[model samples]
Target: MSNTQKINSTITHASINKCAIPYIRYKLVKKPPEKYIKSLQLDLFSQFVTNDKSEVSNTVEIWESIPKYFLTPAQVKKLRTDTGHADPYEWNYSEKGGNFTVRIQPALIKQGNNKYQAFFPGITEELVEEALKKILTIQNHGIHDVNKVETWVRFSLRMVLKELASRGRDRNINQIKHAIEVMSSCVITLSKEKKEIWKGSILQDLVTVGREEYLADTDAQHIGRLPLFISHAINQLEYRQFNYDRLMSCDEQLTRLIYKKLINRYRHANLINNYHFMYSDLKSTGLLQQNREIDNRKKVLSALNELKEKNIIANYETDERKESRAITDVKYIIYPSNEFISEQKAANKRNSDSDKHSIDPNLISVNKS
Candidate 1:
């Protein structure tokens, strides 16, 4: 069978009876109930920053200490041995950003007395990952507290900042604030089959500014709440856990984002050692700015090389089609890493324990037949 046929056949034969484990339980915090959790009636605008000197210092300290515990071999082993009960639901639902495209060009947008700037961020990967995590966090909460269709959630600003790798630098908080503002203001035009399906922004409102005196440098520590529209999209998100440890090993920002994007696109499928993507699509989604195609191609090649060197991925080949003495199309063939396999093994073991001999829902299982 051809590659396309094989992919289609695999997808058709796939029967997922449970959702993939969300996060490594060993890696997550086991915190108690919060007065300000996901709530519809919660005043997100009231979630503000503080003006205390110690708050800023503490935030900085947390940010600095956060990366010390990325995905580790022990953590992977722990997740593999974990036998938590996962909901028996396939993660085949459509992802929000799957078919959409964002032109990371910087531009200013106006919204009723607020002028927001939308730009391609330097920390694009971090923001994207945090956004996905937030979606999961809120949706998981919605499953219990409220309906998951479009529920508003109140999340602590410090929590999100830490997840976003906030270094408590003077500029880190502002950077995150601007990132959210850009997401809220940027225009998203969704299309299918070369036709426009919907046009709107990803975020409905800005972070609620609270009146807390957390730090001297920062005046108001803002708590975040998702608007219904954004939550609606997130509610429909179906995703797999990528190798966070291997991903964090890469020091480059652009490389990390591209790698995550690749995983997000292909993780739903049962890809063993190989995956491919069109050059144009990679350039459109992976590259930061809408720059020259050749330059973008170079950057993509460089990033992929870096990943290969770091052993995140291996054995990658690119197909460059030259027409009229110009490169027209490119196809990338890359293999999964050893770390990726370890993660799949963990998922498979968990599935066996939870659903009693069911197939892995993440579609990342090894074909051990």
Candidate 2:
């Protein structure tokens, strides 16, 4: 169509299909041998940035430059009447007042590390603080651009693949082939460079680390493979590539099938409590009936267990068998270490002397010692 198209066409569709596509493919790349391409339901070109208005105009120029030699102008005349070929060429870019808006989702543009101080370690903490103030604000609220929302996520995905490819090729040209062998997926097509640059599937490979589950299902779309969410899918397939309101029904006999060995090897020695137990106590303070004492025992025990797991209490004695309530160890001792003890004693002595010094001095000092 144009230089851009011609240049992009140089990209191996097979490669893109293998890696980045499965992670973002709209559909049509799934296959066997465990490698298939899938689209992540993104409009890749919509978010493409242009240098200026001239560049957008240049796209049409690129399309106009198609040679008339092997691909003669007659082909275009014939394609005008063709159905399948026309569909691929007909793109609606002018719908939004001359330019397609590309806005990335707030959650999608998230960097690998939200609060990380490393990797970008060379950057100063003060600078990091300011950058984060702005970055996190938009990240939480979503970016405001139509095309950005539409295409930025896929663009990020594209960046990931490109980076991976650049890394491998710079090191060993031969490694390119091996890399392709491993990354060659039938699902989606990507350039060899795209596969090599994209270290792993973006949603799964993890451009950087994050605290929560990286590929959450909120924006995920299904392509076959259960909920083949971004949780992870290999580019192994690129180019070569719920629930409903259930009707009420009677319960049926079900079979218990065990794929692996049955019994639990690790017995439930104990059920240690977590901080949530204490939080529950505070939270349920007013949420219960007048018979509070009835539930107090259970609540206290739950909190005690939680504190114990956290190593807040140190004396580890065996649980004594109990019959009648003999005032079970309700008291817990959290002893300070030697330094802490010394500091505390010093502080106490200082306070005691200060109190003594406060007594009226003139009344007792007249002996002239």
Candidate 3:
């Protein structure tokens, strides 16, 4: 069948608002907002309902291929102590492999800034960021327009709390607010081979306006914005979709990170069932911070067990290398669950269907002929 026929068949099987098709086509090519808004009004005035819920529990890839350690999984108190008396909580980390070097410097705030004190984004901040990304994907805004620094979203603390709740994280309004502050305040400078790639906070220009009591309410709404770079990445389609439900199911920070790493690797490998990684290499991902080898080994084992219990992975085997009767290194062979593989396959098919259907609104008539 023709691409158009295939798309139409799929759309017919799944009831999609016909009026929204024009908007979707326009959005696929990154049309101007005013133009798309006009199209929406003219094309989808009556019987128009956005199917935003279809995006729930899916994430749009935002973070680049930087080391996972960019955002430490360490506890907040330990992170604070490790940074010492340095104002703005600055620290430098470097990793070298083969011919390239990655250098990262993360600070709570830009140098010489005394207004806001932020720390390295821990699990809480990471969760908050993921929630925001989910919101961005659902709303389908900000990402298409990279030139506008003012591209922002207005959402309620209640809305954020609800998203967090879906991930099995029960955080209060105060904690959510703090996570936003940290994300907005923290500045990260990442470079490869001495060439700066990224330099800014995860979020910027956050403006929240609501009374404490009102904001505390479940229905209260507020606003936050993403950085321009993030928007650009989303515009470039440099994102990944993951099952948020499974990610949040892993209770420990390392487990969640490991799950993410595995998913990325598996996807890259075309959904292969088996994959292996050196234990020391995994430790370097910043997911493992325990000082002693035994402690780190225990943490890794526990995380793997949690993944198994959650059915994210079918099973895993570890190989320990010993030098002079002392453990020198470890390796892991991971087997992904059948369910996880099926989920990924379904997601890929959905994306493929969407792509097949995405013809420019202007060209739809010609293509139909």
Ordered by lDDT, highest first, the candidates read 3, 1, 2
Score residue 39 of candidate 1 by CA lDDT: 41
In candidate 3, position 229 carries an lDDT of 37
Runs of candidate 3 exceeding 4 Å displacement: 1-118, 140-143, 146-151, 210-220, 268-272, 354-369
How much is 54 displaced in model 2, in angstroms? 60
Question: What would the TM-score be for candidate 2 when compared with the true structure?
Answer: 0.15
- If both were scored by lDDT, which would come out higher, candidate 1 or candidate 2? 1
Q: Give the Cα error of residue 170 in candidate 1, in Å.
A: 9.6
Tens-digit lDDT track for model 1 on 316-346?
8988899889999888887867755555454
User: What are the per-residue Cα lDDT tens digits for candidate 3 across 35-77?
Assistant: 3221211121111112333333443332433342344534444
- Give the per-residue lDDT digits (tens) of candidate 2, residues 1-369: 000110111122222233223323232122221322222211111112222211110011111111101112343345433221221121112211122211111111112355311011011211111121122122211111221111111112222233333323121322322222212211111122222221212111112123232233212211112112211111111110000000001010000000000001111112242111122222222222225543644444443343344332222222323349653323222222233233234334433443343343422221111
- Candidate achieving the largest lDDT: 3
* Overall local distance difference test of candidate 3: 0.53
Question: 361, model 3: CA deviation in Å?
Answer: 8.2
By TM-score, how accurate is candidate 3? 0.69
Instruction: Point out the higher-scoring one by TM-score: 2 or 3.
Output: 3
